[model samples]
Target: MIYAVGDIHGYADQLDRALALIEADGGPDAEIVFLGDFVDRGPDSKGVLDRLVRGQAESRNWRFVLGNHDRMFLRFVTEGQQHDDRIKSGLSWMNPRLGGTTTLRSYGVGGPDSPAFQPPRGKVVETLVSWWTNQGNLSDQEVIIAAREAVPDAHLNFLATLPLWHETDDLLFVHAGIRPGIPLEEQEEDDLIWIRDGWLEDDRDHGKLVVHGHTALDTPEHHGNRVNLDGGAGYGNRLVPAAFDAGEVFTLWPEGRRPLVPA
Candidate 1:
């Protein structure tokens, strides 16, 4: 059987529970795929990555597709570009406007007790240096520390190496929605990562059971064409996972929520 999970934006405890459910149903033999957006906007981006890497290493059947957040992370590594800057200069302006400042504040920076709110130094540096180094590869302690010192350059290369998408006979996975009318190969990464209304509102098939999580919707909405599994887990919404196998489709929500059958 194959189990595909939705976006897990740094919710380690919730992810642990979901994995436990996966194992309880079937252990290492079960194929597991994570839909992506495994980091950011949560308290423990580092922990989420650590668990995923560890899980994949321990289980040969595990797979992870890159989410838009993951792509942004890769851009940091490959292009030596800031996440928002790579999206558009408009994103840079939108960051502060769209709760970036509030998110930073929630992290205990730039708030009442904030030590120094230095611009240009960037949140990516702060998050990587403080959180990421604490998680993976004890042998690479020195390397990670050195990378943190270099900031934009070293970090960018590390993120660029992640896989952007994955698929199986019954399911298609990505960080964001795909273009409704375009062939999958012809679809642009930007559209896959950033699109919302146009792709979701349209009623057309993209030739796969597209499973994604970037939209941050409150419920796991099915537009009858694709299933959006984001559920905004780290943003105080429920962490959700969708399982698919031949002749059976089920969903698991975090405690205190009800699961829904696909319409």
Candidate 2:
């Protein structure tokens, strides 16, 4: 059996519980597919990433899909690009609406709002940039440099290499839903990681059973068309790790496995 986990959103404690449930219930032969959004919003973004990285390395069963938040993290530390409109050149994912600030804090890099977020001037002024571009992307050198410096080289490397999707003969796993009516092979990157417009509204088939987590829901929903495992774990809700086999789906709750029905 293969287990598909929902969006973790930086809740490392919850992610651990969910994993414990999976290990106890699914056992030695089970493989895992993580639906992404493993960072941001909630507490312990670094912890969440650290755990997943270690888990994946120790066990060969783990698979991961890229989420938009994960992309933002990569952009700040790896690509040095701020794609959000709220972002200025060197803000380092400063916009809190997507919980970038929280994620930054977890890595020991305070947000722009924090007094220590950036120093007016110092040794670290330019030692950590993409090329050590002490030339902060922002007019304010101090603020732009901490986010990159605070994160470790290993974590940045891990974020830079996450896969966009994972597929099996019976199931297709991704961070977000797929575009309806379009073949999976031809779907665009934006649609795979960010599209929600017609992808969620349309009831048309997506060729394969796509298991995803991006659109948050209070409970995990199985729509027959697709399975949504996002339970808003970053927003004080449960972090779900679901088990899928044959044509059935079940969430690994504290009490044990419970059936998850189609939406």
TM-score of each: 0.71, 0.84
Q: What lDDT would each prediction earn against the true structure?
A: 0.59, 0.76
Which is the leading candidate under TM-score? 2
List the candidate 1 regions with Cα displacement exceeding 4 Å.
Answer: 77-80, 83-158, 253-259
Q: How many times do residue backbones clash in model 1?
A: 6
Error of 2 at 149 (Å): 1.8
| lDDT, candidate 1, 1-263, per-residue tens | 57777777667787887777776666657787787777656655556766776665576687776776666544433343333533443342113322222322322333222122224454432221122222332222332333344334322433455566787776777777787877788888777667776776777767777877788888677655677888888576767666665635567543322444556
TM accuracy, model 2? 0.84
What TM-score would candidate 1 get against the native?
A: 0.71
Error of 2 at 181 (Å): 2.1
Residues 1-263 of candidate 2 have per-residue lDDT tens digits of: 79988889889899888888888997855688988888888879999989888877787688888888888887766655545432233334544556776787788655335222342374222122221113333332453467667788778777778888999988999988787877778887777887778878777677778899889999899888798899888789988889986789998877888898875
Model 2, runs deviating above 4 Å: 85-92, 111-141
